[model samples]
Target: MIENYIATHLIDVAALAILCYLIYSNNILNQNRKWPFYIGIMLTVLIISSEAGTIIAGNANGDLRFLNIFCNVFGFAMSPLIPIILLAIYDVNILLTNKLLMLPSIVNMFATALSPWLGFVFYIDVNNHYERGNLFIVFVTAYILNLIILFISTVRTGQKHHYPIKAKFTALSLFVIAGTSIQLIFPSVYSSWHSVTLSLLLYYLLLSEFDGSFDALTRLHNRAAYDKMVNRLDGRKLYSVIVMDINNFKEINDTFGHDFGDTVLKKVASVIRKSFDNSSTCYRVGGDEFYIISSETDPVKLEHQLKCMTNNLEKERKNDGRLPTVSYGYSIFKGGKGIGFQEVLKEADDQMYYFKKIQQDMKKSTQTS
Candidate 1:
């Protein structure tokens, strides 16, 4: 029986072990981000092992009853935590900001801990037989709640980052849900950890692919991503392209430092991200230059979004006087015409330079006055 349990879990354990080695060897994530993966892998391992222990001890003599109770309690306490750890991987700040999210796990932990004595979650009888207690629903509820949170967090993160692989995330969520649900319903089948191991491996690969498309400094889509998006644009779909350049960027870099300039870029990127809706994609296409591609065809709405971006910059300036203003221009492509992307881009660029020239002339006039 113990051999059967080991045989069922051997592949999962080995997969996780290999993943842990790869994570550390490649230095895939920073220290802060890496710990969550490590913890998740560790917890899954513990849960798998304790579950096997529970089965083994439950079938043994009453002398091993203590072991049965310990294993059951440990497994129940740790099982609901896996989803929370997965959630942390996507965005640790979510857990930090929302303390209420932890309430169910905390309650489940205390209940499971006292279950051996109280027999409210699970109990091992004098004959060493394992049986569920009246309040076993506590563990089930906590696990389901955390899974829901994980699913919601994954979707929100994908949307915020404009991840093109949203279908993959959905599949992963459904995969885990199905695997865990099967085990929850069957009780005899051990499939949850197997599913988790595969999910973690896939998630790591997805993050690696997604991170490559982002600008490291500004956290916006990088030039390569921008080019890829431009090349892939459907000629039948309408697009509004907005090009913006920071005013006096060279002066800002020269007066302060490249560090301050980078900060300015990040702030501008944040403003752009907040100003635009999900229908728009923001990119840091070049030094001191940001680009926005919006699906919005309405000119008034596009103008309003641009105004919102500038207003955000003004608000940011109150905190840091060194922050520079931006001049922008936009061009609309109705598509299906002989007009190419380059043509649309050049029109926006010409207008942007014109806007910059006017701003420069006004600054000079004010100085002369």
Candidate 2:
């Protein structure tokens, strides 16, 4: 019995450590304010409860740390909330007014806190072991509700938008929901494995999302990532897509060598990264072409940013005499409708060519003079 308990405890501890590593390494903990706190609290509660259960089971025979069971239950119950909160962080506008969606999480935490007096979760004897009490039903119901909400939210969001990484998230959410639901039905066999498996799956999903969407060279999202965002078009949001290319890029590679061209591309990418919001996605689509899909659809802000970027490039050219000028064309989601993403891309490309032609004409006129 003691050996079995120790082995289980070891597995639980390893799971928690893995969760912590994923949260830190993925940088999700830093992306949103409440996500880290919420996920951290959930994991901490589980670790404490599991260890307490193991120690109590080994030494006291069910008499102590009865509260630890409640902690474990509530922590597992509330785990589903993590992904919902994460999705909200990704799509900030969707759940802005949905505090009710959090009622289940709140209730679980409250139940954990108040379980001692109410004896709502479980009670223990002097031996440091525990058995589930009647109030566990209430906790289970709330937990199931949280899991349902998370699954629904993930599905709805995945359907509403086609982010390159959304499918992976949606699939994992379903798995979590399915696994959690199985635990609810067969608590004796499924409970311990559910959270551990879900945590591991989530870690892989996050890693895959990061790699598929992010450009290694520039640390910006890649073309596949941009396609993911573009395909999910709701006619209500205001935003613009900016397509830009560095003029005469091949000449740079031919004259200064590919290494210098790469340096120039990095410089351009850095400028874009510094110029945009942390939430905004940037991508390198071609050798010298880049795309910035500003979810901020406001034409005014879009124009302002593009103009500022253009002006800065001009200033750099004046100072260094060799700075690359970016030709850009942007299209607003006029009234939240457009022909098609591909069409808009083509329009932007055409306008870019027109602008490049004008620049060439001006250069020739100056040479003739």
Candidate 3:
């Protein structure tokens, strides 16, 4: 029995150990946020080990009955927490924001803790064998509820951040749901922890890739991501590309400092991100320059987004009098007439420079007057 248990869980534990090492060596997580991930790793390891203990003690005689009860209680009490830990790793404040989210897990823990005496969740018989009590469904319900909460949180977070890999996150959540559901339905299957370990590894890889594609300063998609998107554009679909440049950005940097300049860039990026819907992809292509690609073919809607950005910037200017305005120009591709992305980009660039020149001329006239 111990050999079978080892055979089943050895690979999962080893994979988690390697992941922990990689996370430590690469410094993949921010210093402030590393604890949740470490906690998750530790919890997963503990759960796996306790499960093995349960399997071994369940069949043994003598004083091992207490060991069997402890292992079962520990497994039942902690199983629901893995999802919560995963959610915390995604965003710790989620649990804080919704205090009620922790209620189910807390209740599960209480029930599991008392099961040895009350036998409400599970119990160990005189023969040192494990048996489920009448309210075994309580454990299953709590586990499933936490899984659902995790799934919803993942989707909402992706949408809130306008993450490009939102679908991938959704798929990962579904993968976890399916894996756990399978084990719940068929208690003989020991695939749950293994599935979770694999999911964690895959999630880390996906997040690392996603992070590399974003600009560190503005949190917008970077130049390489923009280029990749352009290359992947379907010729049969319409695309509207807008290019924007901050007015007097060099002067701002010179007068204030790079730190303030970075602040301005982040503010502008935030406005731009909020001005458009999910169909739009925003990129910071160069210093003080940004690009937006939207699938919306309607000229009026695109103009409205531009107006929205202008209004948002105006609000920022009110907060900081030194905040500069942005000049933008857009070109629309009507699909397939042999029109290339570069041509559209050049047109937008030319229009942007023309508007920028107009602004320069106006400023000079005002100064001279």
Candidate 4:
């Protein structure tokens, strides 16, 4: 029994030390995300301290009632926070850097901290043993509800930004859920802390990879992510590949200089993002070019959406006359169609060239008139 306690406590301590090392040793901690990283470190350290307290408090000669209380408080506190931390990881504005959105977490922490007086979250018994109080169910329910909301918000946010981090979050949530279940079923195991530590570690490692997938200029998914998305397609889902290019983008660069040209690209990216719905994936495939992939299979709905995208881009010419014009072409293929990626891209490119020619001719005719 002593050996078991020692091992669990060591693992918890090791996890905290490693996390701290990652933060201090790396430049990955930037201003936009430092708070989430700091919060994550806090969660890990609290768990480590609580677990270590549990070990020391188990000593018969030790008078560590405060340690027992701290353990219970920190333990209850960390569970509800996993979901909140996830919101921060994704850089979700509402959950991170927004005090207003933190009301739920604040309320939860306050309620959980009432374990001593109200016996709602947990309490230390006369023997200095930790025990779940009568209202423990309420805390559990609150944690579960936070997880649900986190999942919904993450998926919806990912869809809005054309990111696919929901799968990662789903995996982490499931792991925590399973670990929590096992701990509840067999209270002696003390495995949930280990699971959480490892999960947080892996999640941060994944977070580090996010920068490579994003385009620095536009903050959209870059060509690397584009390749991954295309290569990993299951071939069963209906895919619409819309290829777009700016009209005479070189002229803008030459006329206004690179700085203004960069502004144009950013503006174009914003317009494209706004035009597409959550169901579509947009990529900055190349300079002055973009690729949007959609799984919408319904012809009428798809065409309607495509038309709206077209109008959205065209409207900018009238709305802001200084914005550069863009043209696009799309080719969709379903399962068993045997259409190669290059072939479809070629088709779209061909159509784009054809459209560009028409626009050029119209300009020439209007000038001659």
Output the worst ten-in-a-row residue range by lDDT, candidate 4: 26-35
TM-score per candidate: 0.86, 0.56, 0.88, 0.83
Compare the candidates by TM-score and give the number of the best one: 3
Which regions of candidate 4 are displaced past 4 Å? Answer: 1-17, 20-31, 58-62, 94-111, 159-168, 209-211, 233-236, 297-307, 314-321, 334-338
The local distance difference test score of model 3 is 0.86
List per-prediction Cα lDDT, in the order shown.
0.86, 0.62, 0.86, 0.75
Q: What is the lDDT of residue 172 in candidate 4?
A: 78
For model 3, the run of ten residues with the poorest summed lDDT: 25-34
Cα lDDT for residue 368, candidate 3: 100
Error of 3 at 185 (Å): 5.2
Clashing pairs in 3: none
Candidate scoring better on TM-score of 3 and 4: 3
lDDT score, candidate 2, position 41: 37
| Residues 134-159 of candidate 4: C-alpha lDDT, one tens digit per residue | 87766677667777777787777766
lDDT for residue 241 in candidate 1, whole number 0-100:
92
Instruction: List model 2 lDDT by residue over 1-369, tens digit each.
Output: 555655665666666666656655664232553354346435544654554464444365444455455445555455545555554644455566687777776776676555555556554445545455567776666656755665566556543333444567666656665665675676443343445445454644564465556666776667777776777755566556778889899998898888888877887787777676643567888678898776776767777777777776666668666568888787766553446667667777787788888988998999999
lDDT winner between 1 and 3, please give it.
Answer: 1
Over the full model, what C-alpha lDDT does candidate 4 score relative to the true structure?
A: 0.75
